[model samples]
Target chain A: DAMVIQNPRYQVTQFGKPVTLSCSQTLNHNVMYWYQQKSSQAPKLLFHYYDKDFNNEADTPDNFQSRRPNTSFCFLDIRSPGLGDAAMYLCATSTRGQGGGETQYFGPGTRLLVL
Target chain B: DQQVKQNSPSLSVQEGRISILNCDYTNSMFDYFLWYKKYPAEGPTFLISISSIKDKNEDGRFTVFLNKSAKHLSLHIVPSQPGDSAVYFCAAMTGGSQGNLIFGKGTKLSVKP
Candidate 1:
């Protein structure tokens, strides 16, 4: 079935170390998004890619970056892991609909633990 | 400030009963609403959605009601089952091409058999 998939469901990294999380989609959606969710907090949008264009959230920290090499793959790279950055990283995909209210489909998510 | 809010942190319901999850929004530009369910260690899955043009939308045992004037929406599950227990999140979208969704903190629902 067409679905989103994430690799390394659980990741452990040392402080200040760089880590990357990967996402892929079989749904062939045009948009891909990355979100960080802390315990008991809302999932906050970090960045997204519409086709090849990258859009980053205003409040997203500089440590977080994303790359979309192709339609099916997107990656989130943390330049320097921090204790506060330890959270579940989610990847979502959606088709660019005419009404702008497209439903997003999410991957299983990668839980990052910064030591 | 939070654009979408789910005031209830958690809710408990008995099986075969009704479960109502409420959501409120502070943004008037939000024209579309959605409900997502998340199990532990997994990403949220889309449950149902309602457009601002409509007051309600239903599917199977789940129903979503939108009160645009009040900037509030609710999800109701009829004959709730133990399998339905999960975290429910309310999300809103502005009417544009960006499709960036603003989501509320989730409400964990526990349905006891």
Candidate 2:
């Protein structure tokens, strides 16, 4: 079953501690994305890798960073976790075919809690 | 600022009836749109989509209508089934290549059988 997979469905991190949330895809997609969703709000794009190129949203906090070491995997690193950073982190993948090919497929999402 | 807006926080529909969900966007640059369904503790699943080039798109019992002039779009489910009940999200795509999506706050729908 080719699908996006996220590890540690439920994650707990202490405040000011660095934590990493990871994502991988069996879909072998050309693009991978990271989105942050809070309670009852729209999921906001944190950043994405268009193949090997990483594009970050303007308002994304400096505490957050990502590394797509290769095509199959990507990691979201929170250098200094804050209480407000606790939320569901989602990973999505898509192909880069004709017409932008931005229609994304999502994973189960990682719910992070700050202690 | 949120480009796409779903004003209704939730909706209740009787089974075998019609369910209509609405979405509005402020960005005129958005030419592509999509609707996604989600259940609790799960990620959103793509449901239906409509492009600005077309007025509507339909698949099975799901129909999505686009009004480019009004910058509004709506999803219609006829003879709605309980299985169709879930959180519906509307997303707007701006630019073409390397374009990112702007999503609206979702509306949770419950279908009573």
Candidate 3:
């Protein structure tokens, strides 16, 4: 089945350590997104790639960065992990084809824990 | 600032009854609205959506109503089932630079059998 996959469902990193989360999609969607979700809160858009063009949220901190090497893969890198950075990181994909309003398909999030 | 707001943190309803979830938005520029259902340990799945051009859109048992004037949208589930119990999030989108969605705090619905 074509779906989005996130590596390392649960990740633990020490404070100030750098960590990377990976996402891949089999759906071949042209758009991929990364979101940060705290417990019981809405998913905050971190950044996204529209066919290799990186678009970062204006409020997103500089510590968070993303890279999309190809259509199927995207990575989120945290320059320095902090206790406040612990949250669920979600990956989603969508294609803006004809009849536009495309719904995003999300992958099981990567839960990050910063010690 | 929170653009979308789901006032109810949780709601419980008997099976086969009607479940109504409400959402409000402060942003008048939101032209597209969507609802997503999420289960524990899983990502949210799209449930239904309504465009600003229309007041209502229905699919099977799910119906979404949008009031562009009031900046309010709602999801109604008729004959609710246990499988419908999950966290429901309301998201709004507007055309801009990135075209990213703004989501509200989710509402947890519990449908008892």
Q: Give RMSD to native, each candidate.
A: 0.7, 1.1, 1.2
* TM-score (C-alpha) between model 1 and the true structure: 0.99
Against the native complex, each candidate's DockQ, computed on alpha carbons, is: 0.83, 0.67, 0.63
Q: 1 or 2, which is superior by TM-score?
A: 1
Clashing pairs in 2: none
Give lDDT: candidate 3, residue B29.
81
Error of 1 at B96 (Å): 1.7
Q: What lDDT does each candidate get?
A: 0.95, 0.92, 0.92
A49-111: candidate 3 lDDT, tens digit per residue: 999788888899999999999999999999998899999999999886554356889999999
On DockQ, the leading prediction is 1
Docking class of 3: medium
Ordered by TM-score, highest first, the candidates read 1, 2, 3
RMSD of 2: 1.1
Superposed on the true interface residues, model 3 gives a C-alpha RMSD in angstroms of: 1.9
Q: Estimate, for each residue in A12-113, the C-alpha lDDT of model 1 and write its tens digit.
A: 999999999999999999999999999999998898999999998889999999999999999999999989999999999999867657899999999999
**lDDT of model 3, residue A22:** 97
For candidate 2, give the DockQ.
Answer: 0.67
lDDT per residue for candidate 3 within B15-95, as digits (tens), equals 999999999999888888899999998999999988888999999999999988888999999989999999999998875
Q: Write the per-residue lDDT of candidate 2 for residues B2-100, one digit (tens) a residue.
A: 789999999999999999999999988888899999998998898888888899999999999999999999999998999988999999895474758
Q: What fraction of the reference interface contacts is present in each model, in order?
A: 0.75, 0.57, 0.61
Error of 2 at A48 (Å): 0.2
Model 1 is docked with a DockQ of 0.83
